[model samples]
Target: MERKRHHEEASSESDDENYVPYVPLKERRKNEILKVTKKLGRAGRLLQEEEKKESTDDGGMQDEEEEIQVGPNANMSLLDQHSELIKKAEAKKESAREKLLKEEERILESVAENKALMGVAELAKGIQYQDPIKTGWTPPRAILAMPKERHQRMRKKMEILVEGEDIPPLCITFKEMKFPHIILKALKKRGIEKPTPIQMQGIPVVLMGRDMIGIAFTGSGKTLVFALPIIMFCLEQEKRLPFVKNEGPYGLIVCPSRELAKQTTEIINFFSRHLVEDGYPALKCLMCIGGMAIKEQLDMIKQGVHIIVATPGRLMDMLEKKMVNLDICRYLCLDEADRMIDMGFEEDVRTIFSYFKGQRQTLLFSATMPKKIQNFARSALVKPVTVNVGRAGAASLNVTQEVEFVKNEARMVYLLECLQKTPPPVLIFAEKKQDVDAIHEYLLLKGVEAAATHGSKDQEERSWAVDQFRKGAKDVLVATDVASKGLDFPDIQHVINYDMPEDIENYVHRIGRTGRSANRGVATTFISKACDESTLLDLKYLLIEAKQKVPPFLAQLEAESEKYLEIGGEVGCSYCGGLGHRITDCPRLEAVQNKAAQNIGRKDYLASNAADW
Candidate 1:
């Protein structure tokens, strides 16, 4: 038992020597923090050494090493350093952004200053920027201060007279006319940048709400002169009162022929298209003439139309049928008024005029003003301004006139010769439709591509033929007065009068087809014994006024007619071919007068015989 006790004591002493004591929680936490601090110090020294090595190696090192050295205990300190680096970077980026913004502002201010300086410089140079279409804007006085030579030329070339309350100054360029931007753009697209002499004066007068009598030659841009102002006025009206159902047309354009009406409608619609595209209300222009489906026209009117271009006959038909109305028409234009009257449309025109009740603006445009036209104007117009571009009934100076004294039978041969000598696109004028057909057939047989247009041909065929001629599909066009006055053929090289018209004014219009818009052209007239003596004298003076060379035959005819006036020789009576009186004053009258005188004598003789019985 003593040996076992001694062994137990030795074992207990050994166990006590190996046993460890329990520590407090706070003391354990303190020791752990101290150990982490020491480890962080070591990690910092190692990181410095690695950074030095990386700098020497040009930063070619493993990124994993840096992450491994960062212990969980040191995470807070590393994060704080990262936040400080981010703050420094943000400050530098903000400074750069501010500098850039300041530079951009400076640039914008400099550009604005430069623009202001440029405007001031332009003003100092006596250049003013004027908006032509601005209300109350008058024409610049500088336009009247033209060069002396230019003024002299204008006076000699154009006979412009303005008689009204206040006439607007003449426009040199189309820009000076103060058209809308879209209209100006359209004009530019059409290459019509300059205004003709008549347009320069006539457009403004018409816009002033005054009646105007524009006496200008054909192809003188008269269409635009009246058309522009009418369009502008209609647009103004549209702005005031939007289009309504069955309001009737705002403008009425009367043409002598269906062809002219079609052309005028096309022009109006062309300008109206731009207005529509620019977000304005749709402005529709309809062509109301014969030879088309009236039902379609009526439907168009029902749908809504702003303008109507019509002939007197078709318009009368529509008016009689009550298909259309013109009661609310604000503008009335009579194009080719003389021709309208001469074609026996006077009564129809008067009938149509009676429908308009309220005050309306009227414009009369004619190439010539005769007694009848003057009378019509006096009755219709209200103190209209008479604007004449040149002398009335004067031929164009651009045409070279040639009068050939050919017999009636040789006229065709002479025309063929002229055609062969001249270029393509010759317009031949005849007195009758049969003559035109005959000439057209002959030209076809002669291997010349030709077409004919007259009243007998339907409107479609006539329009097709005109288009063919215009497109150069046909070279020659033979027609009567139907193609004379208002048809615009730009490439007509020659105008040949196969038969002289009875009216000298028709002759002027016939040749007026050529030499239009200041282009050079030729006019050949075939004069025969059938031509009257008075016509010959008129031709002589017309040729002289146009600065054309008068043939010796016309000169001799004029001299022979003047001899009767110079000497006291008896003038031949136009009625009986007797001497000493005019047609109205002729004493040797008709057979009825002689028979009445004989009856009176017989009554006296019977009375004497009764007394003797």
Candidate 2:
């Protein structure tokens, strides 16, 4: 029995020895099959090659036979060989297809193992808030879409300068001001015999070397108020110094924004054109603003500038670089001072002021002078003439003001309703960056061609937004306070305050956006119960004093809102820490529902019937 057991164990050990480190029998069989298949492929190719050689021989024979007698035998041989070649080519193509499929599968497996999809998920997180359809969805096309005819008509309207019958408060007589005979002749050529209230008051005050503060609404010829005096001063000073080809600027005009600076410079250039008729070359004017090449501006400054119109930031930058010499800047003017503070550029204004030393005549003009500005005036102006042209912070008499109460969540919806109910080309103001973006998206979804401008946007974007709003490319512009000052968009029949402004003066500035140039306009304020409604009362009182009829609906709402605060008292907004509604819930915000309503039927309706070339 022991011998038999030992023999069985020996057989087991032999089996283990045979299996150790050797290829499995099943794998060996698969290798043999692959070898056989490869051999078959080689053989098939060889056979195909032989068939081609035979076909060539048959073709030669057929050509030779054609020279004598036509025969079907060569033709049948050629057909059979061609059929065989096609079969082989198709088989090779299938093999290549299979190889490509395998390679694709391997790549997919590798990607899966690496978890590449995780990276995409991470990327999506950054823009999730702005993904319209997923979050309160609004279509982008709807917001930017516009009716073609409306845009065309709006573009046709020109922003006329100084045209009205109120006998511009500052009309000038030929005797009061001392202009060279040449300037007087040029003024006559343009048919401008008298200056507006602003020009009349501002020109002489600026000329007298006294720091002056002129408060006037836009379209009151404010540009000319500063321009005429500066130009006349420069011209007069230039004539005094003979053989002075390169005299420093006799006047400097600083604006809050680039748009205002450009507009002011254009107005100066327009008035200076008459210099050609005066037997003198064109007046040397330099325009310096951000977004333009600094080197070019430096070169211009080096070449010498007679008059410089610039934004506070760029001008300060140039001054720091020693590119601009302020030693000869005897005359200084700050246009749109209120706007500079609103844009957080108060420090820049202070910096620019630092460059000036004793005996410089500083002229500061604003639509409404806030306390900060008052302090600036106290320090900057030297016992100057303070002329308040219009009622301080009162809406224009021609502007009819209205207020609507809406729920905090429904502001966007109310905005669209107001816009649809009102005329085309309405301007909407939003108080926050996110609110402006949200309103812009809602407007686009409503099928209203609209754009927004804010401090967060770059110069090009801001300018494009403003241009689109002005040219009627976009009928509505949702902007922050940047548009509140020095922005003149003609044909804007309505101005909607999506959020009530915190300050009463800002309310006036907001409404001043419309009812401009003696044209009739409407200013609507959207207020929610959560917002401070006292601004409405302040606005109503101011309008009443201005002789404008107050809308009864707003008056009733204002009376009811008085209960929220003590009589003759002010309640501050806890959210914005300001007196009006929380800045976050600014009355300037339009409701989303309002936006959706405008978007309806917009997708199918073409902006214009005119065929696009």
Candidate 3:
């Protein structure tokens, strides 16, 4: 039995050596195709059975039965092999197509990004930073400084008495008498003898310790209107009680911007310069605005300031920190009330109001008092004297309205043309920071002197830019709403609305930057057919309501705005432009790197990247 088993095993081993396993590639391919075919056949048979039961009422079911046959009698292995090869070829083709599509998308994005960078660089090349000269009319300084020659001319044109009528000693309250004679003398030297309309109307009321509301246009001397009375009253209190009272100032002047606060403080200083010079109880002024260290302001207060000029947010911060005490605050002056509201400072205003006592005298001033402002007035002032200077809507009347219809694509070209044609020391306003930057860049590239002022810029940068604008080194300032109010550019011959304002009140505030101090000024607004209802409303508000003439071209453009809206579609690119590109695109992509490098050579990226990196 062992011998037999051994022989069988040997035979099996020899048979295995002689035999080769056949792997028919074609048959295997065919079998795979057949397996798929069999699945399809089985599925078809099941479907036929279902239809035979369902279509007992349909003649189409009978026809389907005749066409369907269930059997393995037919073998088309060759056809199956061919079909399998075809399927493989089709899958390869699809894969290639998908890869090609992905590559194309990537290339298109790269090209678009490069193109955007080039465009930004081109715009940046146009900037001409004109060095500031002390002799020239800088935008704000031209207006604020009020050159001696122009001042003399204005005094001549207007019936301004260099030596104003003196108030009766009785009419001049004890508070008024307490003011350092130096401040009064400075007012006399500046040819500001009599209080202007705002001063005359608002001052006596404020001194009487009443809450008053003064609505007036820019450069109507609103600062002195509220300031003088507050100072006088505080000085009277100081003199009446002597050093027994530790409290310093009873007056608080709240401005909306750092520039406005600074400008207002300067004006106040000028008025009180005599006191400081004479050394008789110097009128100490403290300025509190954002971008400065709070500790510095606190330190100044610690040294005992006589008057407070502050922005809302920082003041509120100080109040919270116990760095300031408003318990003794007897007077409040809100300069540029409209601007404060427009800046979304309503809550801050309310918060500050809560800190002051109810007995304090409140004086509010603004160029335009819309319904919201009127409501604020109702809440703030108690049965206040509402003084409307000029007309409620006539703020822009002092500013001449000129409108230009330009295509969206040709905005830069037309902007350059306008700048070239405009007189020196023009102020240009854009709706958005991006537009401000763009316009600033375009102007620079075209050899036009320009700079921009917006919230994005640091405090020092903004101050420098405004100073340059004020010095006439930069002939034009491309700015946002940040420059709309609280800015006094005295010699601005023209205000160019490179982009129309979003709100009518903003329009009044913007163009009002010019036409200051009874100086005739022209305002040119670039309106595209695609501007929104708000833009149109602002134009109409200026024309019909404000009594400014509507340019013939703006009327035409307004009529055709529907088509423009369809083309531009919206205010900003919802995806790409709104937040610096859409979701699919990485926000971290390199910006127009060389744009800022050529002009400033500081390698500043487009500000949108500031958020990302």
Candidate 4:
């Protein structure tokens, strides 16, 4: 029994030597951390020694010893890579922060520049409210599914210039734009096989409920850009819930000229016709112009209108008279904005805006955006996308320009010769109304079929003359810049500038009468000593830029003006659209500045003499 107990005790002693005690998780973690801390300290010391050895003057023996020590800590090598990565990331972040600061400073500088020009600026750095229309928009599922690079390529191929963030995908085809079947049918009936560049970018953008400023070559189908989208917009509204009597006119198109209002109405009517034929709601479009019976337009308004196309004069008249209500109107378009602003219609536009009851999508379409338009857009438009199809003040490539140095006294005799350059169905533009009448008389006396129209003429006479010219009843039409602004005359193979226009922008529009719809045409301008040096210089630049032949007169003018063209030779004035002159000497800009100064002087004088009042 004694031997058995001794053996058992020895077994218990063996078990005690192998036994491990239970530990709480917290205590175990603390013990593990302490052990790791010790290991790290040892590793740190060893690493320091290794680095020191690497830098020491000692040779083979010490280098080998350092390598041996580093090899034992191979598992911890990721620490070096991890630290380097952290440094790189920190550097990238710092660079990004610097760039952001630079951009902010640039924005502030731009704001200061605007303050110098207009004396108006956003007062403080505040939260800019994003337009709900923009925030609310989402791309169609199919459009979203497209490869982003495809849209980039489309813009490149189409030569579409866009400046905005997150612009909508461009549509290559009308079908791709997702136009309604009926509207597509109307497009097919009109024989429009493809969408123009402006239409491609403008349609999706406007349809997405964003503001836009579109600049494209004349006759590049700008009207359709807004026209089609407006139709689609109204149709969607009507289909959701039919417009009650006098409750609609959900869209409005404002034009600078009565003729443009009439033409735009025709286009709207052309497309809206499909809606009714295919069992959709009747989309009524009214033409409100100066000559039209206001009572008749009012009566049509009473019957309920979905769209109204009007000129500034008549539209402003009705709005002020309470004959129209824009309570439901959410879309507004300014066609030929440059001419409209030139006619002093901008003030009227401001007045008309007072009548609008809510946020509206504003669109300004022009070949050239003037300084006033730029200021107005900055104040009014909320993140408007500027879609310029070509460069500023660019003319169509399809027009072959011919510049002739003809004396003023000899120009009349050369008129018949110029007309002979191209066939009938030609358009002639003169700088003055009297010049138009004189040219018309000369053409008739010469027994050439011709018609004449100008601003002073009644709308009926002008309409008849334009109708006669379009229907082939008259072979030629002679007019001032009035007829040249946004008038479409088919088969117009030739354009004659009997006198160079006072403004280069007008000259662009006058020549744009030809070279339309992919049809090549010719423009002949008669330059003489009567022309201003500014006009002549601008003409020289236009010819050279167009790659046309510059007569000796213009070449000499260019050489003489080389001093002025030394700076900003490649670009023209954005404020005036004059290629020959810089902004510092731009007559229009100078005149505006002087006028503003006078106004300010008058205000100061009034304030100083307040007691007199």
The candidate that achieves the highest lDDT relative to the unseen native structure: 4
List candidate 4 stretches off by more than 4 Å.
1-129, 132-140, 370-372, 559-570, 594-613
lDDT of 2 by residue, 1-613 (tens): 9999999999999999888587965467557756765788978567656755775888867444545544554446778978978999989866864664455345334322221111132323421221111111122343226554442343233211222121112224534565667667766765567765556556655555556677776555566667777776676656666324344666789888777787678778877877766665556788888887888776766666789999888888888877777767777888876667555676676667566533466677777664334444444455556655553344567777776667778888888788975677989987888899999999899798999988888888988888887788988999887678776665888999888876676677778888766678888887766565555655555655666666665556544323332211223222111233322233422232355557865643554434442
| Least accurate 10 contiguous residues by lDDT in model 3 | 129-138
Which has the greatest TM-score?
4
| By TM-score: ranked, best first | 4, 1, 3, 2
Better of 3 and 4 by TM-score: 4
What is candidate 4's lDDT per residue for 1-613, written digit by digit as tens? Answer: 9999999999999999999999976467557756765788977567656655675767657545544554544545688868877999989866864664455345334432342111112223232336726423345678779997988888888899888767888877788777778888888887788988989898888878888889888888989988988888887788888887778678889988777788889888988888789987778999999876688998899988989999888988888788889899888888887678677775677677667666778888987665445555655566778888876667788899988989998998998898888888888888788988988998899999999998899999988998888899999898888777777765888999988888899999889889988889999999888888887888888888888888888788753334445332336554577888755456666677688799999999999899688
- Mind giving the per-residue lDDT tens digits that candidate 3 earns over 420-472? 66578988888888888888888888788888899899888898999999998
TM-scores of all candidate predictions against the true structure? 0.67, 0.58, 0.60, 0.76
Candidate 1 global TM-score: 0.67
The count of backbone overlaps in candidate 1 is 0
Model 3 segments beyond 4 Å from truth? 1-184, 188-194, 241-249, 544-548, 556-613
Order of all candidates by lDDT, from best down to worst? Answer: 4, 1, 2, 3
Pairwise lDDT winner, candidates 1 and 3: 1
